[model samples]
Target: MKTTLVLAMTADGKIADVTKSPPTFGSDRDYAHMVEQILLADVVLVGSGTLLDGNESSEVREPDRALIQARIDRGQTPQPPQIICSRSGKIDPQLPFFSQPIERWLLTTKKGSLDWIERASFGRVLVCETADGSDIDWQAVKVKLAELGVENICFLGGSELAASLFAADFIDELWLTICPFIYGGSAAPSPVSGVGFTSDLAPRLRLLSVDRVEQELFLHYQVEKKSEDIPPT
Candidate 1:
C-alpha cells in the first residue's frame, strides 16, 4: 500500500511538549490539510495510545465535506476504514472511535489477551503474530491490509508507530506541517520516536511541494532510497 505519515510538528521538530501530550500548535488550515489527505486514503491508522489520548473519531467531520465529496467523486468511500495497532490489543472499548459509524479494525498479535474479546463486537479483530514473539509482524499486516483492498494508508498517530513504519521503510510519503513555535526540552516528542537510523542509513526525503499559510509551512516529501539503502518492506 502507499503509506503516508501526516502530522504537524513545531519548529524544533517536536510533535508534543515536555508534558508528552499531543500538542495543539497548528492552525485550522493545517487541520483542513490533514482532513484532505485523510479523504484520499483507503485506511487510516492510529496507535492505541494516540486513540485513547483523545475522543477522536475516524469518520469525516462536517468541516471536511468538500474533501469527502472529492473522494466520493473519485469513486472512493466517504470515510476510509480506520485501523488501530496495538501489539497486545489492550485498547479501551469505550473510546469514541469505537462508537463511530466508520469501519474499525484492530491489528494486533496473537499475544493479545481475550480481555478485549468482548469489544470485538465494535470492530473486526485481526490477530497476527510471528513465531519469534516479536511485535505484530508488519509484513503480515501489509499483506492483510492488501487483502482488505487498502491501497492508500494514512498514518495519523503517535511517534512510536511512526518510527516502526519508517524503520521498516513502509512509509512512502510524509506530509508535514511545521508550526512557527518552539517547545524545546529533552522530553519533547518528535514525529518519529524509537531506535532511529544512523546517519549513514538515514532515510532521505525528496521534497514534492511546499505551501505556506501565514506562519506555518506545509511540506510534502516523498521518501527516497539512498546509496546506503534501507531494505523495502
Candidate 2:
C-alpha cells in the first residue's frame, strides 16, 4: 500500500496556531490541491480529534464532479471511505463528520471503548492492536487495507497519528504546503509529534519536487526507508 501524509504548516513549521485553531493559513488553491489528492485516494485516514475539530467532514467537494468521474473511470469508488483512528475510541457521535455520505470507519484498539459508536451505526469497526500494548498494529492495518483493495491511502490526521505512521515507516510520500505566517509557540503542533526519533533511526526525505504559489510553498518528498527502518514481520 502507498501511504501519503498531507498537511499545511506555518512558516515556522507549526501546523496549528498558538490558540490551536484549525489550520486556516493555506489558501483556497492549496485546499483545491488537497481535494484533488483526496479524490485519487482509495481511503482517507484521520484521527478522531481531527474529525471533531468543529469543521465540516473531509468528504470530497461536490463541485469536483469531473474528478470523481475520473476516479470512477479508473474503477475506483466515487467516494472513498474515511477511517478515523482512536486509541481510546472516545469520538463524539454528534460531530458533523459522521453525517457525510462517504463511508465512515473507526479504527481502534481492542480494549478501547466504543459503546456509542457501535450503536450509532456509523460504519465498520476495525480493531487494530499489538500484543505488547493498546497501540495500533500498523502492519495488520496495512494488510487489511490491501485485502479491501486499498492501494493508495491519504492521511489527514493530527500530529500524533502522523508520528505513529511515520515511526512505523508506513508513510511513503509527504505533501506539505508551507504558509507565510509564523505561529511560534510551544503549544503549537508540528507535522510530526509524539515520542520523536533519535538521530540513527530518523527517516530521511528525498525531495521529489517543489512548487511556490504566492507566499505558500508546496514540497513533495519521498521517504527513504532503509531495510532496518521497517519493523520485522
Candidate 3:
C-alpha cells in the first residue's frame, strides 16, 4: 500500500527540458535503473498530459525490459496495472494501449466523462466525487489503488500530479534523476509544480541511495513525515 514516485530531471532542476517531454534527458545507466524500479512496482501511474503527447508533452514508449520478463517468471501475469489521472478524459482514443483489454485505471472528476469512462469500461475508470463533497478527491486515488491490491506504485511523474501526491502525503519514496544542465528560463516549468499545498509541512526525505551516471546524479529519497524524520525546508 506504499506509493513511490519515480522521475528523471535535469541538473538545472527541470523535469522536462522546456516541452514537458519525459523518459528523456537520462543516460543509458539511468534508464536501466528506471527499468529495475518499474519491474518491481505493482502499478504504474502517469498523468493524462504525459500520454497525450502534445507540443507541451512528448511521447513516451511503453517500457519493456527484463524486469517484465522476470515478473512473468514470478507468476505476475500480464504486468502491473496502469493508472492514468485525466480530469477531462482528453486522452487519445487511438492509443495502441487501448487496443487490448488490459487492466488500466483512469481517475476523473467530470460527470460528462462518464460516457468516456463507459467507452473505456472495457478497462476501469473511476468517476470520483471531490473531497469537499463536490468533486474528485484525488488524494483518495491511491487509497483506492491500495484497496484494489496494489502493493507498489511507480508514479512515472511529470510535475503537476507529483505535486498533488506530495501534498496528499501519499508519496513514500522518490527516485529523481538529476541531469547536469539547466535549460528553462524564468518561464520554464519548475521540476515540481507544488505550491501552497503541503500536508506534512516541512516534509522530510531520507536519502535511500544515490548513483552517478556520467555527469548526472540519481537521488532516491525515502519520504518520511516530520513524525518519522526531521523535516526539510
lDDT of each residue in 145-216, candidate 3, tens digit only: 667777888887657777777666778898888877667665556646757445637556889898776798
Worst 10 residues of 2 by lDDT: 113-122
RMSD of each: 3.2, 3.5, 3.7
C-alpha lDDT (0 to 100) for residue 227 of candidate 2: 68
Predicted structure with the largest TM-score when compared to the true one: 2
Clashes per candidate (backbone, < 3 Å): 0, 0, 4
lDDT (10s digit) by residue, model 1, range 1-233: 79999999999999888998757898999888888888889889989878877666556788778888899999888898888888887777676777787888787877674666675534677776677755877778788888878899999978899888887778889999999999999898888888988986778887889999999999999997444443464
Of models 1 and 3, which has the larger TM-score? 1
Which residue pairs collide in model 3, if any? 11-179, 129-135, 130-135, 130-136
lDDT of 2 by residue, 1-233 (tens): 89988888888999888777788888998998898889889999998778777445578767988999999999988988888888888877777776777887788887664564447545678887888757899999998888888999999878889889988889999999988998898988888889999988888887889999988899999988766344344
Question: How many clashing pairs does model 3 include?
Answer: 4
Candidates arranged by lDDT, highest first = 2, 1, 3
lDDT to native, each model: 0.82, 0.84, 0.68
- The C-alpha local distance difference test score for the whole of candidate 2 amounts to 0.84
Model 2, residue pairs in steric clash: none
Off by over 4 Å in 1: 116-118, 226-233
C-alpha displacement of 62 in model 2, angstroms? 1.9
TM-score computed on alpha carbons, candidate 1: 0.90
Q: Which parts of model 3 are misplaced by more than 4 Å?
A: 19-23, 54-65, 96-102, 110-112, 132-135, 196-200, 231-233
